[model samples]
Target chain A: SQQGEEDPQALSIQEGENATMNCSYKTSINNLQWYRQNSGRGLVHLILIRSNEREKHSGRLRVTLDTSKKSSSLLITASRAADTASYFCATLLRDATNKLIFGTGTLLAVQP
Target chain B: SAVISQKPSRDICQRGTSLTIQCQVDSQVTMMFWYRQQPGQSLTLIATANQGSEATYESGFVIDKFPISRPNLTFSTLTVSNMSPEDSSIYLCSVGAGKTEAFFGQGTRLTVV
Candidate 1:
């Protein structure tokens, strides 16, 4: 079953603008990760935030997790045209198998 | 970090024909996973493969339709059997350390006519 939903199915922004995408999941998670996919290619891992941690950052990407709310968000600051792609949030359940459940993605189009 | 190589980056197949996608990892890994992504949609995990064991499939997926082989820790394959137009989608292989980040293959895009 699909674990989560991402808000703003599609987003359009200009270069240097900030883009934010949100994800909400159901079950308890050990960690939540952000990934980027250009066109229809493979996914590139961005950053991961553990349930025990509130937020994480890498380069121009910022991710925040709220366990109580069962939601998380990814913010890209000073976005560039190269950042235009589909962003996804995946959850690693605390269960034994350690399978990663991916959420519905957010498509961000950064216009140059 | 693991480097994964997947074969047949894209293919156009006739209905009723089957296609097998292979995934090879640079290093040995315990668990591997397969996922399917339909057009303009999110990825849905098909199954989890453990070396020397039967693949554990998720709901709405069957071993007969999508058979998996984990012959060893560094290699695995997924075959889409009795292919149909509905089966046309991008298939990806992934591997990860326990509860950590995952590494993905380039993905095989299958289009059935």
Candidate 2:
């Protein structure tokens, strides 16, 4: 079953600006991960924030996790047109099986 | 990270026919998974492929309709049988090598006529 629900289903922003997306899940998770997918393509792993980590960063991407609220947020700094894509947040539940439940996703369009 | 190669990248098939998409991974993994993404919708897990055993299918997915084959640790295949127009979507194969991160292949874009 789908657990994560992303807000701001679609967003448009100018280049050099920052974009933020939020996600909420129903169940507890081992980790929350963000991914990027260009049109008609595969997903690229962006960043992963463990349950123990409140926040983490990689390059210009920052991710924050709130296990108590079962929510997470992704912030992209200095967004570029190339960053335009559908971003999805996936959760790995505490179960032993490595199944990932994906969110509805947020479509971000970076205007040049 | 493990590299996955999936094919045929895209295909157009008739309603009564079947299409088997293959996924080959560079490194061995304990489990491989199949997911389907409908038009403008999020992906749904179809099944989990485990080596040397029958695949565990998810709810709303059946073994008769979506058969999965995991021959080894690094390879698997998913067959969409007797497909209909509704089956037209992106089929992705994924594997988790470390922690909770998964690696995906360029998905198979299937269009059932």
Which candidate tops lDDT?
A: 1
What DockQ would candidate 2 receive versus the native complex? 0.67
TM-score of chain A of each: 0.98, 0.98
True contacts kept of 1: 0.70
What is the C-alpha DockQ of each candidate? 0.76, 0.67
List runs of model 2 lying over 4 Å from the truth.
Answer: B97-100
lDDT, candidate 1, A19-109, per-residue tens: 9999999999999998899998999999988999998889888899999999999999999999999999999998998899999999999
CA error at residue B102 for candidate 1, angstroms: 0.5
The 10 consecutive residues of candidate 1 chain B with the worst lDDT sum are: B94-103
For A7-49, candidate 2 gives per-residue lDDT tens digits of: 8899999999999999999998888999999995899999988
The clash count for each model shown is 0, 0
In model 2, pairs of residues that clash are none
Native interface contact recovery, model 2: 0.57
Show where candidate 1 strays beyond 4 Å.
Answer: none
